[model samples]
Target chain A: MKTYLPPKSTLIVWQIRVTVLLALLVAVLYWFIADYFLVLFCVSLVLAVVFNLIYFPAFLRCYSISVNQNAIIIKSGVFIKHERILPFPRMIYAEKQQTLVAKAFSVSALVLRVARAATLTVELKDNDIAEIMKAVAKWQ
Target chain B: MAVKLKITAHPIMIFYYLKPFWFVLIIPLIKAIVSAVIKAEVNNVLLNELFISVVLITYSVIKWKKLKINISSDFIEIYLGVVRRRYANIPINKISTIETTKSPLDYIFGTQKVKINTEAGKQGSADFWFKLNVGDVKKVTELYPEKVTPKTIKFSAVRVAVMAATSSSAFTGIVLVVPIINQAVRLLGTAVTDLLLDRINKIGQLFSKFMPPVVNTVTVVFLISYFIAFLISFFKSVNFKVVFAGKKTGVFSGLLVLRKVLFNTKSVNSVCIEQTPLMRFFARYLLRVGIGGYGNRKGDRAVVVPSAKRDEVHELFSVLFPKFEPADNKIKPHKNTRWRFYYLPTLFLAVSVILYLVLSYSFPVFKGLISFGFIVTACVLAYYYSLAEYNTKHSCISVAPVIYANYTRWSATREMFCEHNRIGIIHITRWPVDKRKNTCNVRLTVRSEAAESITVKHISYNELTDEIKSLYQI
Candidate 1:
């Protein structure tokens, strides 16, 4: 089974963005309360950084998507792992979508519309997206 | 056949436009007459009513004139709208269902409303009319002769009545009547309201004279609403039957307004056999089918069997889904995982206990009653959790070309069967605790915008994955 991982830099950028957002939230709370929330904010900031440092690497490592002749397997999550197998026949459509951040990072997301109600999104390099689409076409 | 055969709908459809505004017209007309009699100034009120009536009539006339239904060999095109000139071209093959409804007014006018429901979701059915004198329902049925012919199964009047009486639809009817009841109370005045309440209190006194006023009032309201609900349900499903012809299922029902509905069986997303608490005691089940395009956006699904015995349900299932089996090989969650079901309820009880302790300090008089209520709630929660655990244990998934899932919702258990090919997505979620326990929640979603999903919690993750891979050859 072949495996593909998202760009490592993209994960780092995402984590940095999340950390910044949390810092802004904490700053807003500090502005409002001006109490022992300063201590709580510091603790939260450290915990968030530590948790992200530990989880993001594991997530990057574990987050592998593989497309076979019949099914697309999405293996994700760090502590609690998820291995979703979406069969080709069951997939309604597959499209490559790029957000502003993803476009800046030169990465794209392959969104698979599965069965009636479920969708699976896997991040891939811009170049790899075309390859995945070709693979999907071949399977079809 | 001509290239394009254009025809105007029966003139009765003009009334369809006016039907919605009838109340608007009637309310003001009544007010105008009352004001005229009370205040001797009739000209302004009468003029206002006449002006509104004229505008409504003109609008309906314009709408009626513009509405044109063109029947081609391949498609049915509807052209209407005065300002926008809207055009709708529905392919004949894509037409999933055709329903005809006949109100008392329609019967008197020798006409009926024909609603053409295409495989379009949410947009709603396209309604026209059939002039009983000009064209019979046979003309529409003749267009799809092969699909329309089916073996009909008519429910007995007694059976229909029983089914309706036991249905939860009565509860919804009771909810609808609440506003009407309120309006009536307001219109009739407090004297009538007090009399009714007194009568209800007297009836409640018969049950338990020592009961609190609040409890007595609640009991009386419940009894009255339940009776009204029974009447509504009985009337709604008075004449119910299902006609199975090839791949199409025709449902004919209604009492005052007759409804003849037809839909393709292939479009059925899932079959749900639901039984309310009352029906559970009688061993009766209501079988409803969710259609794909329509989704489960309320009343979209057709009730093939409104109410039936266990054996009758089995027969209905066999007839509807001949290729699929309704029975399942049961799967049980690990005993250790039963904590998952009990965790939330136990936490709730703990929170309630803390609240009781805190609040009892302020209100000492109600402390004993509150404690008793809390204990009763805790006991009920414990019993409910036990039932939920049992439901999880019995819930099973089977694959035989089609997937059949047997699970419980609240106290009522249901068996849902859907084609494997129709399954859109299968989601398996595991929490950190579940990771350690090796148990996960599995959800099978069918293609419906309404998100019709079947979730089976606390199942062995490895077992389910292995089973799916082997069974589906994925």
Candidate 2:
């Protein structure tokens, strides 16, 4: 059995994505209500800093993917912990998906398509994505 | 025997073909009527509607004529489109489910609706849907391979009637009645509907001395609706039968409009035995199986048995899938966490009592009625909560190559049997409260075209991890 932890670059990418989303939200609010633009901007900045510096790292630490000959087990969630297991025989196919932002960070998302319209997705480094795909293909 | 390779859909296809464009087609007719009413152009309006009707009919006829299907040894080819002329060739072995249903409209037209589902397309909608003549439908079904056997089972009318009564609920009855009542009001016009409402009001007023008129009227309507729903269920379950051929299972039933569905037994993902609180009391069960490419909506999964006694259900299940059986060993919830089951209901009872005290004082005239109603509601809720607790205590799970779970969902209890290979995901969740209690919830989802899940609640956290570790060595 091999356990893979997401690279720190993936975490950085996610933090950047969140910061962009917060900036967009504040811009939208400023367009609608100019009176409170400064306050909204300050709140958004604090939220982004707190979330990226504290919450995201804790979340990344908790999330992991373990692959064995039998199944792929995912352990995730911060406060309300969740452990999900997907057996290999139930897997239909696997594919790699990379967005422009993730590509810039050398990170990509691996999607495992299983039966019954269920999908499991996780972000990993390019080498890790290749290794996982090879392992899944061998099982198939 | 020589088989026909090329086939055309029945005339009933016109209805399906026009369904999507009905709104667009009606707008012109409505415009014509409005113009005629305002401008007194009756002659022109008649001519316009006639022309529009002729064009629509001609379009549907031409489209129907152009649409054709060719069934080859290894593939099915469908020729579609009026001007573009597109074709799709689906491999025969890739077909997942073959469903044939006859709605009331199809019955009137002497046709059957066929939906061919494959895993390639959208989740809820079928890949290929067309209406065919009864003879053509038989020919189509023949093209699919099947190994016929002698095993068969039939559901009797008496069992179906009992099942209908036990499974029927007021909510379903109300949903089925609302449309019919709306249509009736439209047909009867304002004056007749007003008279009916006035009579109902008077009846309610006549009972005002005893209780609130609204309550009286609602109770009567609810009872009537429930009875109507029960009758509908009975009719739907009439003449239910199942035939188990070697690799294929065929189900045939329906009252006014006969329905037929054929499934590849190997493609079946899971078997579910469902029982409502009432059915539990009567020791009855409804058996259903989840098959690939089958819709997930209510009444979509193939019903192996509509309703049956406990022993009969077991017998049928053993015959259908001899290798798999319901789990016997039970894992009751820990004694420490058992009180969580009654927490919500006890809170509700307390609130109801407080409300009674406050409302009785404010409304002196209706005090007796309020007290009686609240007390009855409290008693029923208490009874329901006790039953739920009993069910929770009995919930069991087995983690093996094939998982078996019997768990309570809301007020209904469902027993799920599924193979490990067919399981999509096993999720063990620990909420904030559950973390404090040292318990967790386990959810198992079966793999099919649609998602079907079974959840077990309030189990010891250590026990769950141990079970998962034993099964998958996680």
List clash counts for every candidate, in order.
4, 1
- Candidate 1 residue lDDT tens string, B48-95: 887888888898889888777767676666666664344444455455
Model 1 Cα lDDT, one tens digit per residue, A46-137: 87777578767777788888878888888888778898998865553455555556667777677564433345454578777767665654
Candidate 1, TM-score vs. the true structure? 0.62
* Candidate 1 lDDT: 0.68
Q: Best TM-score goes to which candidate?
A: 2
Candidate 1's DockQ: 0.03
* TM-score of each model, in listed order: 0.62, 0.65
Candidate 2: residue A86 Cα off by (Å): 18
| Chain A TM-score for each of the predictions | 0.83, 0.94
Candidate 1 local Cα displacement, residue B69, angstroms:
2.2
Candidate 2 lDDT, B1-474, residue by residue in tens: 122488998877776777775676666677777878898767865686668777877888888987788887766767655633334555455566788888888867778888876554457777678888878887777776566654788988987776676666743445434444443333333333344456787754444433344444655676686777777777877888988888778888889777778777777788888887677667889888887776635523778888887788878888888756645544556788877778778888888888989987886655545655686677678776966576566777877676888887777788788887777788889989999988987888876666778887788888777867877877
Off by over 4 Å in 1: A1-140, B1-7, B19-55, B72-74, B123-136, B147-149, B169-219, B294-299, B326-364, B367-386, B467-474
